[model samples]
Target chain A: MMHSRAPVNAVIMPRMTEAVVDVRELRKTFRVSEREEGLGATLRSFVSRHRKDVNAVAGITFRIEAGEVVGFLGPNGAGKTTTLKMLSGLLHPTAGEARVLEYVPWRRENAYLKSMTLLMGNRTQLVWDIPAADSFRVLQEIYRIPEEQFRATVKELTELLELGELVHKPVRNLSLGERMKVEFAAGLIHSPRVAFLDEPTIGLDISMQSRIRRFVAEYNRRNGATILLTSHYMDDVVALCKRVIVIHRGRLLYDGPLADLAERMAPYKIITATLHDGAASSADLDAYGTVVSREEGRVTIRVDRHVAPERTARLVNDLGDRLADISVEDPPIEEVIDRVFTSEQTTVSA
Target chain B: MIRIYRALLVAQIQAASQYRVQSILWMLFAVIRPVIFLAAWVAVARSQGGQIGAYDVRDFAAYYICLSLVINLVTSWNAYEFEFEVRMGRFSPKLLRPLHPIHYSVVENVVWKLTTIIPLGIILVFLALTFDARFRTTPAHILLFVPSVVLAAALSFLSSWVLATLAFWTTRVHAITTLWDRAGFIFAGQIAPLALLPGPLQAISLALPFGYVLGVPAEILRGGVSVSTALVLMGGQVFWVVVFYVALQRVWSVGVRQYSAVGA
Candidate 1:
């Protein structure tokens, strides 16, 4: 909306051709009924069932273009996975209008299911006792992939994931990371146009995580597949998503560039500096910025974006001899989110 | 669907191969049931002048042996499998797949029995020798019984599918399955032939699909049924298979709806 005549809108705006995914005012609530243990409680519940409703996702709306990879960001219980389940036809919204790739997902028709894939980490779909290749073969049948196409895709994915050595090992024998890689290969062998990855790298080590990240990125690039990724690790968001949608407490909080999010919630950048002398006065540092922490001339400051350059320049020019080392950095993404979600509870504008 | 089943079968076999000790243990251990029944029935026949319900002890031996072999082939463990799969959230992955999950589970259950059948057959053979029971070979009986057992397998699979899908509602389909298992055991003629049960229980056996799997086929194999009567019972198995299949479809839709409501 800020860019009045956005050029990217022409080719990429999810248009009349049919939004690949459209969700508006989506809502889901669970009726948590109290169950009495004994005969008295049972009889009481029969007459007066105490019901509590937990609103998992409340009045959320969004759209995805034909081939956009959008990151879904939210703290646990913020309804990110709930939304994903609705999109993938695993769950239905209690009240809402929604569509995925031109089909009502809760219907979960063979046609709609054929064109989409869901991959979740930690919870496995593979047969635990079998080789990963065996699991992959089963997927081919489930998706009704043509023999040749299934072969070709399995070959390509196996090579891309470097799964040759790992694919034949029994699933129970494979390391967690190895199993996840093969899970991806099995999920994607059908070459679905839409992929929902929920915490797909949840428990993987750094190297394995990056390997999966690269594989996903490469797959998207090659096929122009639309992706909806959810992860707790902020680095996953930073590495994979250009556009992110943030939700908190079952409500949409922010939908925009990730960089803009960090900028908006945390308006100030962090700076750590060490001085030549341990006796630098804390009061003197206030002129430069809000002194977050100062210890033996190892001072930390929060400098507002507008004043960061001038403040740093002054600190350098005025305290040349006193300053030993200075480094300006962005606060961790988690801190930015904590402020946005917990501290300021700002209503999201899409 | 068949293709999906074949793949799942291959995978289950691979999984079974991983723990050779456990796999063998399961085979040797579960084999006790048929032998126990065989012994009990043999004792009954001996006390009753080597016959009960027109079966000499030798005939009872042959009947129970064949029952054990075919029952082992046809029975499914989905009721137990679903309890775990549903309770632990393992059922989600199957819902995510494009194929009907029943196919995956059905194939795996049948394949697992392939290993157990030998032990079952061995126990049955042992009974045949010890009981001095009437035993006979009839090409006609084999011809009719084979397809009856297969149809029985389908019936068993679909009934359990309906039962397992109830997880979406109560989350404790396990308790319900215990009843189903007991009913299957009694009415399906696991403990004894339908003819040997009291009159009222026999009526209930006829009303349910259980006897069609174990009793009807085993009945014919023991020279109990005329070819015409055998034809009618086989028709009954086929009929119930359709009924159970349709029931499975209805339960699946309702279960899926309930699962959606629960956000499962």
Candidate 2:
């Protein structure tokens, strides 16, 4: 196994080309009141309140280049949403600095706001009682989109999203997936250069999720916009993001190309072999590696990444006539991510 | 900015029109308070030999009817609504837009007032016929009343917005808004005419901004105020409008900094 740790406070300098989004040691602390679930505690809280500070975002630093799609990965309470809020100007950080499009986000200047958008899956900006097209018209006015441009954008979005009749019906009458599609179209009406998407595919069916993933990928491809996306679904990350930033409990655990995540964190490979008819029993496979599963003439083993090649070669040689088929590959991304979070000593940078 | 307001206004009107039944019901509900006050005052005037403090039955009817219309025009619920928006994290979407969130609230208020105007007019006609109300108004009073009402609405909306911005620090603003409403009821002559109050209370009513929000406009419309006095009251309305506008800006800037954007 191989591992390396960057200093927690290390600062990574940006490249020659200016980054579209840059954050340095951003932090947010919330003072939340506490009380027991009883009348006595409630009465006492009125006289003397008990409060505690929660560090929702603890000194995270990252830079995103223009036109790059980056996956922001974390478990629940991992501060992904907090960081997005700070960058989108929905929240003011307790400390540190962040610049998006060369403007301080929290200043919320019109020029800054005009250049970016934040889309939350659980929330909606469309007026509930009106058709989504009407809401889109309002967005056009708010963003100051010209009439010709607004019409062309709407046409392109409708064709891309297949929003045909959905835009004509009131938003309240639409299904969740239909509403989400409309939401995406509305959020992008201005063609924002920077987009922060928080769980944009959440709670959608598998087919809808795949559709949304494709839409996001195509949107990025066509517009060349920089996007920071947060999702619990591994499929979303695999489909769209080339690079990922992982956090745990408000601490940055990893930042690198997605291809290197498993190599750096799991440090292991999985090998599967199909034995010939009655050629060798499961017990005979012990010398090769840790047998993870053996059933129906197939045996799967976990081997350290460093020696996986040698082990596979030996197994093939020993079972020359007995081995019908064999394959070696990295472990599943979900499994690798799980290992990264569970392994207390695991942290890597690239 | 005006274009954005126009778009919001159109959208709000479309949304509000979807709930016509609810709007009419709310308008009817709003009529109850002024009607009850008018009935009580008229009864008192009758018992006091057909007059009390320069208000006969007809005069009482005119005052209450005008008060009802003025209240309807200037009423703002942003204080209560803003608290809910902040608590439930609905304000986040508004903050993301290039326009200020206050623009949405302002347009919604204006659209709501506009949508209820026909219904309010019918109700006004019914009330006048039932109470035998006689209004005394000159062209001068009528001309002055328009700006008075506009200024009153601005003052009321801005003050409520300032109170609403307090929700960033205290998520529950019901108590604060209730206190404000109580103060308006006392000092704005919503409960009784300012002339009928004690001298000390009359001075307090004149000194506070609430009288400008409700009482002055109503008085001007009923021809109870002379031209010079109407000018002075309009000046007072303008002063409060500026004060509340500045206060709203200051409070809103500080409050947005404190926003936690909870619930998502």
Candidate 3:
């Protein structure tokens, strides 16, 4: 669907005219080059270098209203992280415009900077030698957080992130997950209005991942902090974001509700049958739709939602004695995504 | 900003504390490099009957002893570290703060040098006793020395701001910083007093800001300063500050533009 701003501008009044984050037709290009090997080519390349321009992010624009939690989704090298950096004012864009809280992001004004935070996974933002709490004290000084507000935010985040005991331990001694939790707490001490998370759960165990995911969700719910979260982990996107923007090859491939994209990818059903007497030499379920997998006593196949009943009935009639059990379900989200990525110009659901 | 400076210094202390052995070893290396120079220069002076350019072996010992102490105190390698940070993408966090990253760097450099000061002072005391070094000073010069030392440190830091931003457009800033670093030693009079250099070399020394930062204040601390010499030196100090201050504006803008263009 077309992402238009005319309606968004018309509906809002003249007085309450603040968006926490906004972007339009943003682009970033890199002058990357072919790697020359050996002394000969390297010497020759210096005289007249061969260069290729990589469009890291090409004309993808979307706005996050105040307190909106939007998931940025794409495969590897899809420019989600690049886009986040541009919005956070770490990098400037080659074309188009972006604004955060009514200030130009690239200008990186102190006031605009004070109102935002950016967190990247696998990066150390805390002082590594000191106790996590002491690093927080350093942040308190840097951000000029008033004692009262600093204490309240620290206490709230510590409790929510379960950092009570971990706070006292040196950052070097803490586990990766523990350090990440403290990092988040330190980031929020200033009470920034916007937060950018780049792969926040890239290398955490299942339990730790949930702890971080829960902390992120709870923090947003309580504080109404506008968040743009980028994670390859589909679970993070599914659990936290109602709306997701997907980019492929630096282009906006999808931008809408998560459920809508999933619905569009896999609009049919897959049925798995367990048989008692079906000892066929081979399995050929393609007449119905497509066979996904087959075993000795079980076979799974996908069928159009409207034709599922007919397909199920035929399977039962053909192997009534062997039909021990049968089940029907929608395709997995991963599979739907795989199909979307594999084919283009298919009958995508609106 | 002062409050932030204090905390940044304390935080760097805590961070460096993790590598306690490395710090001690570095201190040891610091001692060896200067003492070796002191011994060699002193030997050369004594061979010439205890005199080289108005400095006897004792004077040489004292000059280098003080040089060793102050060089470590004012020199900041944070610019090279900043270059690394930009290349590795760690600069994003620094830029996200409400204050310019340079403020943090400036604070940390001051703090880091001060933290190392105690250990360095101990070495200085040992050298003074070993070499019969003299550190005579008047209260007036002592008062002036404080601001001079602070200005020297600021000048040293601001010059690096340009070096650090070189990473925005090119690789090998570490090499570039090292090249300039050696320039500081040769021209800033870190190795020899500006007066001892040949006329042309002395001209080169005075023309560059490095001498104002390291050599000039250093001479001031040695306590034979006339009022005019002190004024001229401090005036030269202010000139360097204004020069580097303007350089930072150009460097920062281009650096940020380069960063965005590359989508870093």
Best by TM-score: 2
lDDT of 1 at A148: 95
- The 0-to-1 C-alpha lDDT of every candidate, in the order given, reads 0.79, 0.89, 0.78
Candidate 1 off by > 4 Å: A1-18, A34-49, A146-152, A278-283, A295-297, A324-330, A344-350, B1-3, B19-31, B260-264
Residue B149 in model 1: lDDT? 77
Residue lDDT tens for model 1, A110-204? 89888998888877777887777777777777788899998899889988899988988878899999889988987888899999999999989
Tens-place lDDT per residue, model 2, B190-247, is 8887778789988998888989999999999999889999999899999999999999
Better of 1 and 2 by lDDT: 2
Stretches of model 2 off by over 4 angstroms after superposition: A1-14, A275-280, A295-297, A320-324, A345-350
Worst 10 residues of 2 chain A by lDDT: A1-10
Q: State which candidate has the highest lDDT.
A: 2
Q: Candidates 1 and 3: which is better by DockQ?
A: 3
lDDT of 2 by residue, A46-114 (tens): 999999988888788889999999999988888999999999998899999999999999999999898
**Tens-digit lDDT track for model 1 on B158-219?**
88888888888887688898998888788987788778899999998988887886788777
Error of 3 at B200 (Å): 0.8
- Candidate RMSDs in Å, in order, are 4.8, 3.1, 4.5
